[model samples]
Target: MTAMMDREAFEAALRQIGAERYHHLHPFQQMLQNGQLSREQVQAWALNRYYYQSQIPVKDSHILARLQTTELRREWRQRIIDHDGQEASEGQPAQRGGIEKWIALTDGVGLDRAYVESGAGILPGTRFAVDAYVHFVQEKTLLEAIASSLTELFSPNVIGTRVRGMLEHYDFISRETLAYFDKRPVQAKRDSDFALEYCLENARRPEEQEAVLNALRFKCHVLWAQLDALCFAYVAPGLTPADAWQPGTAEKENPRS
Candidate 1:
Protein backbone atom coordinates (compact mmCIF):
# COMPACT_ATOMS: atom_id res chain seq x y z
CA MET A 1 0.00 0.00 0.00
CA THR A 2 1.18 3.52 -0.71
CA ALA A 3 2.02 5.70 2.24
CA MET A 4 -0.15 8.68 2.98
CA MET A 5 1.16 12.12 2.14
CA ASP A 6 1.72 14.71 4.83
CA ARG A 7 -0.92 17.39 5.29
CA GLU A 8 1.17 20.00 3.50
CA ALA A 9 1.83 17.65 0.61
CA PHE A 10 -1.81 16.65 0.41
CA GLU A 11 -2.86 20.27 0.27
CA ALA A 12 -0.29 20.93 -2.45
CA ALA A 13 -1.67 18.03 -4.46
CA LEU A 14 -5.15 19.51 -4.21
CA ARG A 15 -4.00 22.91 -5.44
CA GLN A 16 -2.13 21.27 -8.29
CA ILE A 17 -5.40 19.77 -9.54
CA GLY A 18 -6.84 23.28 -9.75
CA ALA A 19 -3.75 24.61 -11.49
CA GLU A 20 -3.94 22.05 -14.26
CA ARG A 21 -7.60 21.20 -14.75
CA TYR A 22 -9.80 24.11 -13.64
CA HIS A 23 -12.17 25.52 -16.24
CA HIS A 24 -10.41 28.86 -16.05
CA LEU A 25 -8.07 27.29 -18.59
CA HIS A 26 -10.88 26.24 -20.90
CA PRO A 27 -10.96 27.89 -24.34
CA PHE A 28 -14.45 29.28 -23.86
CA GLN A 29 -13.42 30.76 -20.55
CA GLN A 30 -10.36 32.38 -22.11
CA MET A 31 -12.47 33.93 -24.85
CA LEU A 32 -14.88 35.18 -22.23
CA GLN A 33 -12.22 36.76 -20.06
CA ASN A 34 -10.51 38.29 -23.10
CA GLY A 35 -13.73 39.77 -24.50
CA GLN A 36 -13.64 37.74 -27.68
CA LEU A 37 -17.27 36.63 -27.58
CA SER A 38 -20.26 38.45 -29.10
CA ARG A 39 -23.20 39.72 -27.07
CA GLU A 40 -25.33 36.78 -28.09
CA GLN A 41 -22.57 34.46 -27.01
CA VAL A 42 -22.33 36.18 -23.64
CA GLN A 43 -26.06 36.01 -23.27
CA ALA A 44 -26.00 32.31 -23.98
CA TRP A 45 -23.32 31.92 -21.37
CA ALA A 46 -25.31 33.79 -18.75
CA LEU A 47 -28.49 31.94 -19.52
CA ASN A 48 -26.84 28.55 -19.35
CA ARG A 49 -24.71 29.38 -16.33
CA TYR A 50 -27.80 30.40 -14.45
CA TYR A 51 -28.60 26.69 -14.34
CA TYR A 52 -25.31 25.99 -12.63
CA GLN A 53 -25.67 28.91 -10.20
CA SER A 54 -29.15 27.83 -9.22
CA GLN A 55 -27.81 24.39 -8.30
CA ILE A 56 -25.14 25.58 -5.86
CA PRO A 57 -27.46 25.51 -2.90
CA VAL A 58 -28.94 22.20 -3.91
CA LYS A 59 -25.56 20.48 -3.79
CA ASP A 60 -24.71 22.30 -0.58
CA SER A 61 -27.92 21.04 0.93
CA HIS A 62 -26.89 17.50 0.12
CA ILE A 63 -23.56 18.11 1.81
CA LEU A 64 -25.27 19.75 4.77
CA ALA A 65 -27.47 16.75 5.29
CA ARG A 66 -24.46 14.43 5.51
CA LEU A 67 -22.48 16.52 7.95
CA GLN A 68 -22.29 14.74 11.32
CA THR A 69 -21.60 17.60 13.66
CA THR A 70 -23.45 20.78 14.51
CA GLU A 71 -20.35 22.91 14.02
CA LEU A 72 -19.85 21.44 10.58
CA ARG A 73 -23.51 21.77 9.70
CA ARG A 74 -23.50 25.38 10.88
CA GLU A 75 -20.55 26.17 8.66
CA TRP A 76 -22.10 24.35 5.72
CA ARG A 77 -25.53 25.92 6.17
CA GLN A 78 -24.10 29.37 5.51
CA ARG A 79 -23.38 28.31 1.93
CA ILE A 80 -27.06 27.58 1.31
CA ILE A 81 -28.02 30.88 2.90
CA ASP A 82 -25.47 32.68 0.78
CA HIS A 83 -26.93 31.25 -2.42
CA ASP A 84 -30.64 31.21 -1.44
CA GLY A 85 -30.63 34.35 0.73
CA GLN A 86 -32.79 35.18 3.70
CA GLU A 87 -36.49 36.00 3.49
CA ALA A 88 -37.81 39.35 4.67
CA SER A 89 -39.28 39.15 8.14
CA GLU A 90 -40.79 41.26 10.90
CA GLY A 91 -37.98 43.77 11.22
CA GLN A 92 -35.53 43.17 8.39
CA PRO A 93 -35.41 43.61 4.66
CA ALA A 94 -34.96 40.61 2.39
CA GLN A 95 -31.33 40.15 1.54
CA ARG A 96 -30.58 39.13 -2.00
CA GLY A 97 -28.84 35.81 -2.62
CA GLY A 98 -26.33 34.64 -5.19
CA ILE A 99 -29.03 33.01 -7.28
CA GLU A 100 -31.03 36.27 -7.39
CA LYS A 101 -27.88 38.19 -8.21
CA TRP A 102 -27.25 35.75 -11.07
CA ILE A 103 -30.77 36.36 -12.33
CA ALA A 104 -30.02 40.06 -12.34
CA LEU A 105 -26.94 39.29 -14.43
CA THR A 106 -29.05 37.43 -16.94
CA ASP A 107 -31.55 40.28 -16.80
CA GLY A 108 -28.79 42.77 -17.41
CA VAL A 109 -27.88 40.82 -20.50
CA GLY A 110 -31.49 41.11 -21.77
CA LEU A 111 -32.76 37.60 -21.06
CA ASP A 112 -36.36 37.30 -19.90
CA ARG A 113 -36.19 36.26 -16.23
CA ALA A 114 -39.04 33.80 -16.63
CA TYR A 115 -37.26 32.10 -19.48
CA VAL A 116 -33.93 31.94 -17.73
CA GLU A 117 -35.52 30.53 -14.59
CA SER A 118 -37.60 28.07 -16.55
CA GLY A 119 -34.50 26.12 -17.65
CA ALA A 120 -36.44 25.42 -20.79
CA GLY A 121 -33.78 26.89 -23.05
CA ILE A 122 -30.63 25.64 -21.33
CA LEU A 123 -28.37 23.24 -23.23
CA PRO A 124 -28.63 19.54 -22.56
CA GLY A 125 -24.96 19.63 -21.62
CA THR A 126 -25.57 22.29 -19.00
CA ARG A 127 -28.40 20.37 -17.41
CA PHE A 128 -26.45 17.13 -17.46
CA ALA A 129 -23.30 18.69 -16.01
CA VAL A 130 -25.05 20.54 -13.21
CA ASP A 131 -27.26 17.58 -12.33
CA ALA A 132 -24.24 15.28 -12.32
CA TYR A 133 -22.59 17.56 -9.77
CA VAL A 134 -25.56 17.47 -7.44
CA HIS A 135 -25.70 13.70 -7.74
CA PHE A 136 -21.97 13.53 -7.05
CA VAL A 137 -22.40 15.38 -3.78
CA GLN A 138 -25.25 13.15 -2.78
CA GLU A 139 -23.52 9.86 -3.60
CA LYS A 140 -19.89 10.52 -2.78
CA THR A 141 -18.21 10.24 0.58
CA LEU A 142 -18.31 13.39 2.66
CA LEU A 143 -14.57 13.93 2.30
CA GLU A 144 -14.84 13.71 -1.46
CA ALA A 145 -17.85 15.99 -1.47
CA ILE A 146 -15.98 18.73 0.38
CA ALA A 147 -12.88 18.26 -1.75
CA SER A 148 -14.97 18.81 -4.88
CA SER A 149 -15.66 22.36 -3.77
CA LEU A 150 -11.95 23.13 -3.83
CA THR A 151 -12.52 24.52 -7.35
CA GLU A 152 -13.27 27.71 -5.51
CA LEU A 153 -9.52 27.89 -4.98
CA PHE A 154 -9.05 29.05 -8.57
CA SER A 155 -12.26 31.06 -9.06
CA PRO A 156 -11.10 34.39 -7.63
CA ASN A 157 -8.53 34.93 -10.35
CA VAL A 158 -10.99 33.98 -13.07
CA ILE A 159 -13.61 36.30 -11.59
CA GLY A 160 -11.16 39.19 -11.54
CA THR A 161 -10.18 38.73 -15.18
CA ARG A 162 -13.75 38.14 -16.36
CA VAL A 163 -15.10 41.20 -14.54
CA ARG A 164 -12.36 43.51 -15.82
CA GLY A 165 -12.47 42.26 -19.40
CA MET A 166 -16.23 42.25 -19.71
CA LEU A 167 -16.58 45.79 -18.34
CA GLU A 168 -13.85 47.10 -20.64
CA HIS A 169 -14.93 45.40 -23.84
CA TYR A 170 -18.66 44.79 -23.76
CA ASP A 171 -20.83 47.87 -24.30
CA PHE A 172 -23.74 45.87 -22.96
CA ILE A 173 -22.01 44.92 -19.74
CA SER A 174 -21.93 47.08 -16.63
CA ARG A 175 -20.44 46.62 -13.21
CA GLU A 176 -23.92 46.48 -11.79
CA THR A 177 -24.79 43.71 -14.21
CA LEU A 178 -21.74 41.80 -13.06
CA ALA A 179 -22.58 42.33 -9.41
CA TYR A 180 -22.67 38.60 -8.67
CA PHE A 181 -18.91 38.36 -9.00
CA ASP A 182 -18.11 41.20 -6.60
CA LYS A 183 -18.97 39.12 -3.56
CA ARG A 184 -17.86 35.70 -4.82
CA PRO A 185 -14.11 35.97 -4.36
CA VAL A 186 -14.44 36.59 -0.64
CA GLN A 187 -17.09 33.92 -0.22
CA ALA A 188 -15.15 31.42 -2.29
CA LYS A 189 -12.00 32.04 -0.32
CA ARG A 190 -13.75 31.46 2.97
CA ASP A 191 -15.45 28.32 1.71
CA SER A 192 -12.42 26.85 -0.03
CA ASP A 193 -10.24 27.39 3.01
CA PHE A 194 -12.65 25.44 5.17
CA ALA A 195 -13.07 22.65 2.61
CA LEU A 196 -9.32 22.32 2.05
CA GLU A 197 -8.72 22.07 5.76
CA TYR A 198 -11.40 19.45 6.11
CA CYS A 199 -10.07 17.27 3.30
CA LEU A 200 -6.47 17.55 4.39
CA GLU A 201 -7.29 16.62 7.96
CA ASN A 202 -9.73 13.83 7.28
CA ALA A 203 -8.23 12.09 4.26
CA ARG A 204 -5.73 10.19 6.36
CA ARG A 205 -5.10 7.04 4.31
CA PRO A 206 -3.48 6.99 0.90
CA GLU A 207 -6.66 5.80 -0.80
CA GLU A 208 -8.74 8.40 0.97
CA GLN A 209 -6.37 11.12 -0.18
CA GLU A 210 -6.58 9.78 -3.72
CA ALA A 211 -10.35 9.90 -3.54
CA VAL A 212 -10.16 13.50 -2.41
CA LEU A 213 -7.84 14.39 -5.28
CA ASN A 214 -10.06 12.62 -7.77
CA ALA A 215 -13.09 14.43 -6.43
CA LEU A 216 -11.51 17.75 -7.26
CA ARG A 217 -10.60 16.43 -10.65
CA PHE A 218 -14.18 15.28 -11.20
CA LYS A 219 -15.42 18.75 -10.37
CA CYS A 220 -12.91 20.29 -12.72
CA HIS A 221 -14.27 18.06 -15.47
CA VAL A 222 -17.81 19.09 -14.62
CA LEU A 223 -16.89 22.76 -15.12
CA TRP A 224 -14.81 22.15 -18.20
CA ALA A 225 -17.58 20.07 -19.73
CA GLN A 226 -20.00 22.96 -19.34
CA LEU A 227 -17.66 25.19 -21.29
CA ASP A 228 -17.14 22.53 -23.92
CA ALA A 229 -20.89 22.45 -24.41
CA LEU A 230 -20.96 26.23 -24.76
CA CYS A 231 -18.10 26.26 -27.23
CA PHE A 232 -19.76 23.64 -29.38
CA ALA A 233 -23.18 25.26 -29.29
CA TYR A 234 -22.07 28.88 -29.71
CA VAL A 235 -18.59 29.01 -31.17
CA ALA A 236 -17.02 27.53 -34.31
CA PRO A 237 -19.65 25.85 -36.47
CA GLY A 238 -22.16 26.89 -33.80
CA LEU A 239 -24.53 23.96 -34.11
CA THR A 240 -26.93 25.05 -31.42
CA PRO A 241 -29.14 22.27 -30.16
CA ALA A 242 -32.60 22.05 -31.73
CA ASP A 243 -34.48 23.35 -28.70
CA ALA A 244 -31.80 25.13 -26.70
CA TRP A 245 -31.65 28.90 -26.37
CA GLN A 246 -31.06 30.61 -29.68
CA PRO A 247 -29.77 34.15 -29.61
CA GLY A 248 -32.31 36.88 -30.52
CA THR A 249 -35.16 34.44 -29.97
CA ALA A 250 -36.41 35.12 -26.46
CA GLU A 251 -34.80 38.25 -25.10
CA LYS A 252 -35.89 40.99 -22.74
CA GLU A 253 -35.20 44.69 -23.32
CA ASN A 254 -31.54 45.38 -22.64
CA PRO A 255 -31.54 47.74 -19.70
CA ARG A 256 -28.21 49.11 -20.86
CA SER A 257 -29.54 49.74 -24.35
Candidate 2:
Protein backbone atom coordinates (compact mmCIF):
# COMPACT_ATOMS: atom_id res chain seq x y z
CA MET A 1 0.00 0.00 0.00
CA THR A 2 1.25 3.46 -0.84
CA ALA A 3 -0.19 4.80 2.37
CA MET A 4 0.23 2.87 5.56
CA MET A 5 -3.06 1.58 6.91
CA ASP A 6 -4.29 1.80 10.46
CA ARG A 7 -3.84 -1.32 12.58
CA GLU A 8 -7.39 -2.60 12.00
CA ALA A 9 -7.05 -1.95 8.28
CA PHE A 10 -3.73 -3.78 8.23
CA GLU A 11 -5.19 -6.80 10.01
CA ALA A 12 -8.11 -6.75 7.59
CA ALA A 13 -5.71 -6.72 4.67
CA LEU A 14 -3.96 -9.76 6.06
CA ARG A 15 -7.24 -11.64 6.47
CA GLN A 16 -8.16 -10.71 2.94
CA ILE A 17 -4.99 -12.34 1.73
CA GLY A 18 -6.00 -15.54 3.50
CA ALA A 19 -9.51 -15.39 2.08
CA GLU A 20 -8.29 -14.91 -1.45
CA ARG A 21 -5.24 -17.16 -1.50
CA TYR A 22 -5.19 -19.72 1.31
CA HIS A 23 -4.81 -23.39 0.45
CA HIS A 24 -8.21 -24.08 2.00
CA LEU A 25 -9.47 -22.71 -1.31
CA HIS A 26 -7.43 -25.17 -3.34
CA PRO A 27 -8.96 -28.13 -5.18
CA PHE A 28 -6.80 -30.73 -3.47
CA GLN A 29 -7.90 -29.46 -0.07
CA GLN A 30 -11.52 -29.60 -1.17
CA MET A 31 -11.04 -33.15 -2.36
CA LEU A 32 -9.35 -34.29 0.83
CA GLN A 33 -11.74 -32.57 3.23
CA ASN A 34 -14.85 -33.62 1.34
CA GLY A 35 -13.77 -37.26 1.06
CA GLN A 36 -13.58 -37.17 -2.70
CA LEU A 37 -10.12 -38.69 -2.45
CA SER A 38 -9.65 -42.40 -1.99
CA ARG A 39 -8.10 -43.92 1.11
CA GLU A 40 -4.81 -44.39 -0.72
CA GLN A 41 -4.85 -40.76 -1.75
CA VAL A 42 -5.50 -39.75 1.84
CA GLN A 43 -2.60 -41.95 2.86
CA ALA A 44 -0.38 -40.15 0.41
CA TRP A 45 -1.47 -36.74 1.65
CA ALA A 46 -0.82 -37.68 5.27
CA LEU A 47 2.55 -39.23 4.54
CA ASN A 48 3.77 -36.30 2.47
CA ARG A 49 2.38 -33.82 4.97
CA TYR A 50 4.33 -35.46 7.80
CA TYR A 51 7.42 -33.70 6.50
CA TYR A 52 5.75 -30.33 6.87
CA GLN A 53 4.43 -31.19 10.33
CA SER A 54 7.81 -32.39 11.46
CA GLN A 55 9.57 -29.23 10.35
CA ILE A 56 7.31 -26.79 12.20
CA PRO A 57 9.53 -26.79 15.27
CA VAL A 58 12.61 -26.46 13.12
CA LYS A 59 11.22 -23.28 11.55
CA ASP A 60 10.10 -21.93 14.91
CA SER A 61 13.52 -22.65 16.38
CA HIS A 62 15.21 -20.56 13.68
CA ILE A 63 12.93 -17.65 14.56
CA LEU A 64 13.52 -18.18 18.25
CA ALA A 65 17.27 -18.12 17.80
CA ARG A 66 17.09 -14.66 16.28
CA LEU A 67 14.80 -13.00 18.83
CA GLN A 68 16.75 -10.40 20.79
CA THR A 69 14.67 -10.29 23.96
CA THR A 70 14.06 -12.85 26.66
CA GLU A 71 10.40 -11.78 26.82
CA LEU A 72 10.03 -12.40 23.12
CA ARG A 73 11.82 -15.69 23.39
CA ARG A 74 9.63 -16.70 26.28
CA GLU A 75 6.56 -15.81 24.27
CA TRP A 76 7.82 -17.75 21.25
CA ARG A 77 9.21 -20.83 22.93
CA GLN A 78 5.73 -22.27 23.53
CA ARG A 79 5.37 -22.71 19.79
CA ILE A 80 8.34 -25.02 19.74
CA ILE A 81 7.04 -26.92 22.75
CA ASP A 82 3.64 -27.26 21.14
CA HIS A 83 5.13 -28.96 18.11
CA ASP A 84 8.15 -30.72 19.58
CA GLY A 85 6.68 -31.72 22.94
CA GLN A 86 8.03 -31.13 26.41
CA GLU A 87 9.89 -33.99 28.01
CA ALA A 88 8.29 -36.03 30.79
CA SER A 89 8.64 -34.95 34.39
CA GLU A 90 8.76 -37.02 37.56
CA GLY A 91 5.08 -37.96 37.46
CA GLN A 92 4.08 -37.47 33.84
CA PRO A 93 4.45 -39.55 30.74
CA ALA A 94 6.01 -37.98 27.68
CA GLN A 95 3.51 -36.10 25.65
CA ARG A 96 3.63 -36.77 21.95
CA GLY A 97 4.05 -33.70 19.78
CA GLY A 98 2.01 -32.75 16.75
CA ILE A 99 4.44 -34.69 14.58
CA GLU A 100 3.84 -37.82 16.59
CA LYS A 101 0.09 -37.27 16.49
CA TRP A 102 0.37 -36.86 12.73
CA ILE A 103 2.15 -40.18 12.66
CA ALA A 104 -0.82 -41.68 14.46
CA LEU A 105 -3.06 -40.34 11.72
CA THR A 106 -0.78 -41.95 9.16
CA ASP A 107 -0.91 -45.24 11.03
CA GLY A 108 -4.67 -44.97 11.32
CA VAL A 109 -4.64 -44.77 7.54
CA GLY A 110 -2.42 -47.87 7.31
CA LEU A 111 1.00 -46.37 6.53
CA ASP A 112 4.24 -47.27 8.25
CA ARG A 113 5.44 -44.61 10.69
CA ALA A 114 9.13 -45.27 10.04
CA TYR A 115 8.64 -44.98 6.28
CA VAL A 116 6.69 -41.76 6.70
CA GLU A 117 9.22 -40.30 9.13
CA SER A 118 12.05 -41.24 6.81
CA GLY A 119 10.80 -38.60 4.36
CA ALA A 120 11.36 -41.33 1.85
CA GLY A 121 8.16 -40.87 -0.13
CA ILE A 122 7.60 -37.10 0.01
CA LEU A 123 7.05 -35.27 -3.28
CA PRO A 124 9.63 -32.88 -4.70
CA GLY A 125 7.17 -30.00 -4.69
CA THR A 126 6.22 -30.64 -1.06
CA ARG A 127 9.84 -30.56 0.04
CA PHE A 128 10.56 -27.40 -1.93
CA ALA A 129 7.56 -25.54 -0.59
CA VAL A 130 8.20 -26.44 3.07
CA ASP A 131 11.91 -25.67 2.77
CA ALA A 132 11.03 -22.29 1.26
CA TYR A 133 8.86 -21.53 4.29
CA VAL A 134 11.67 -22.38 6.72
CA HIS A 135 14.11 -20.26 4.72
CA PHE A 136 11.64 -17.39 4.63
CA VAL A 137 11.64 -17.33 8.41
CA GLN A 138 15.39 -17.73 8.59
CA GLU A 139 16.39 -15.09 6.03
CA LYS A 140 13.69 -12.42 6.32
CA THR A 141 13.47 -9.56 8.76
CA LEU A 142 12.02 -10.56 12.14
CA LEU A 143 8.94 -8.46 11.41
CA GLU A 144 8.45 -10.17 8.07
CA ALA A 145 8.98 -13.57 9.65
CA ILE A 146 6.29 -12.83 12.22
CA ALA A 147 4.03 -11.56 9.47
CA SER A 148 4.33 -14.83 7.60
CA SER A 149 2.99 -16.69 10.62
CA LEU A 150 -0.22 -14.66 10.49
CA THR A 151 -1.58 -17.48 8.35
CA GLU A 152 -2.49 -19.03 11.71
CA LEU A 153 -5.29 -16.47 11.96
CA PHE A 154 -7.32 -18.24 9.31
CA SER A 155 -6.44 -21.79 10.30
CA PRO A 156 -9.02 -22.40 13.01
CA ASN A 157 -11.96 -22.25 10.65
CA VAL A 158 -10.28 -24.42 8.06
CA ILE A 159 -9.25 -26.95 10.70
CA GLY A 160 -12.80 -27.17 11.95
CA THR A 161 -14.09 -27.74 8.45
CA ARG A 162 -11.47 -30.38 7.78
CA VAL A 163 -11.94 -32.23 11.05
CA ARG A 164 -15.69 -32.35 10.79
CA GLY A 165 -15.74 -33.28 7.12
CA MET A 166 -13.18 -36.01 7.48
CA LEU A 167 -15.05 -37.50 10.42
CA GLU A 168 -18.40 -37.34 8.74
CA HIS A 169 -17.31 -38.80 5.43
CA TYR A 170 -14.43 -41.14 6.07
CA ASP A 171 -15.23 -44.29 7.99
CA PHE A 172 -11.59 -44.80 8.76
CA ILE A 173 -11.19 -41.36 10.33
CA SER A 174 -11.91 -41.33 14.07
CA ARG A 175 -11.77 -38.52 16.56
CA GLU A 176 -8.69 -40.10 18.02
CA THR A 177 -7.03 -40.47 14.64
CA LEU A 178 -7.48 -36.79 13.84
CA ALA A 179 -6.35 -35.74 17.31
CA TYR A 180 -3.58 -33.60 15.89
CA PHE A 181 -6.18 -30.92 15.15
CA ASP A 182 -7.81 -31.09 18.55
CA LYS A 183 -5.74 -28.38 20.18
CA ARG A 184 -4.72 -26.49 17.05
CA PRO A 185 -7.50 -23.94 16.96
CA VAL A 186 -6.71 -22.62 20.41
CA GLN A 187 -2.97 -22.82 19.82
CA ALA A 188 -3.27 -21.08 16.47
CA LYS A 189 -5.25 -18.26 18.03
CA ARG A 190 -2.61 -17.76 20.70
CA ASP A 191 0.21 -17.78 18.16
CA SER A 192 -1.57 -15.54 15.63
CA ASP A 193 -2.59 -13.02 18.24
CA PHE A 194 1.03 -12.71 19.31
CA ALA A 195 2.24 -12.52 15.68
CA LEU A 196 -0.39 -10.00 14.53
CA GLU A 197 0.27 -7.76 17.48
CA TYR A 198 4.00 -8.00 16.80
CA CYS A 199 3.53 -6.97 13.18
CA LEU A 200 1.25 -4.07 14.06
CA GLU A 201 3.72 -2.82 16.62
CA ASN A 202 6.88 -3.26 14.54
CA ALA A 203 5.88 -2.33 10.99
CA ARG A 204 5.84 1.45 11.23
CA ARG A 205 6.83 2.65 7.76
CA PRO A 206 4.66 2.43 4.64
CA GLU A 207 7.21 0.21 2.91
CA GLU A 208 7.49 -1.90 6.04
CA GLN A 209 3.74 -2.42 6.15
CA GLU A 210 3.77 -3.44 2.51
CA ALA A 211 6.55 -5.88 3.17
CA VAL A 212 4.60 -7.41 6.03
CA LEU A 213 1.56 -7.81 3.81
CA ASN A 214 3.66 -9.39 1.09
CA ALA A 215 5.23 -11.76 3.58
CA LEU A 216 1.82 -13.10 4.50
CA ARG A 217 1.04 -13.43 0.82
CA PHE A 218 4.25 -15.36 0.35
CA LYS A 219 3.29 -17.71 3.17
CA CYS A 220 -0.04 -18.29 1.45
CA HIS A 221 1.79 -19.20 -1.73
CA VAL A 222 3.83 -21.76 0.19
CA LEU A 223 0.59 -23.46 1.17
CA TRP A 224 -1.11 -23.12 -2.21
CA ALA A 225 1.88 -24.50 -4.10
CA GLN A 226 1.89 -27.74 -2.10
CA LEU A 227 -1.72 -28.45 -3.01
CA ASP A 228 -1.10 -27.53 -6.64
CA ALA A 229 1.71 -30.03 -6.86
CA LEU A 230 -0.40 -32.67 -5.13
CA CYS A 231 -3.40 -32.18 -7.47
CA PHE A 232 -1.35 -32.36 -10.65
CA ALA A 233 0.64 -35.37 -9.60
CA TYR A 234 -1.90 -37.45 -7.72
CA VAL A 235 -5.43 -36.12 -8.02
CA ALA A 236 -6.31 -35.18 -11.61
CA PRO A 237 -3.58 -35.95 -14.08
CA GLY A 238 -2.77 -38.91 -11.79
CA LEU A 239 0.81 -39.16 -12.89
CA THR A 240 3.17 -39.61 -9.99
CA PRO A 241 6.23 -37.44 -10.47
CA ALA A 242 9.62 -39.07 -10.92
CA ASP A 243 10.97 -40.53 -7.65
CA ALA A 244 7.76 -39.57 -5.84
CA TRP A 245 5.35 -41.89 -4.08
CA GLN A 246 3.16 -44.20 -6.15
CA PRO A 247 0.36 -46.06 -4.40
CA GLY A 248 0.44 -49.45 -6.07
CA THR A 249 4.02 -49.98 -7.12
CA ALA A 250 5.84 -53.12 -6.06
CA GLU A 251 9.23 -51.49 -5.53
CA LYS A 252 10.88 -52.63 -2.30
CA GLU A 253 10.65 -49.12 -0.85
CA ASN A 254 6.84 -49.33 -1.08
CA PRO A 255 5.78 -45.78 -1.79
CA ARG A 256 2.44 -46.49 -0.17
CA SER A 257 4.23 -46.93 3.12
Task: Output the number of the TM-score-best candidate.
Answer: 1
Compared with the true structure, what per-residue lDDT tens digits does model 1 show for residues 82-158? 99989999999998899999999999989999999999999999999999999999999999999889999999888
Per-residue C-alpha lDDT of model 2 across residues 1-257, encoded as one tens digit per residue: 49989989988888899999988999889988998998778888888889999989999999999999999999999998888876799999888788878988887887876778888788899999999999999999999998989999999999999999999989978898899999999999999999999999999999999999999999999889988888878887887887887885312254234
Residue pairs with clashing backbones, model 1: none
The number of the candidate with the highest lDDT is: 1
Cα deviation of 219 in candidate 1 (Å)? Answer: 0.2
Model 1: runs farther than 4 Å from truth?
A: 89-92, 253-257
If scored against the real structure, what TM-score would every candidate get? 0.96, 0.95
TM accuracy, model 2: 0.95
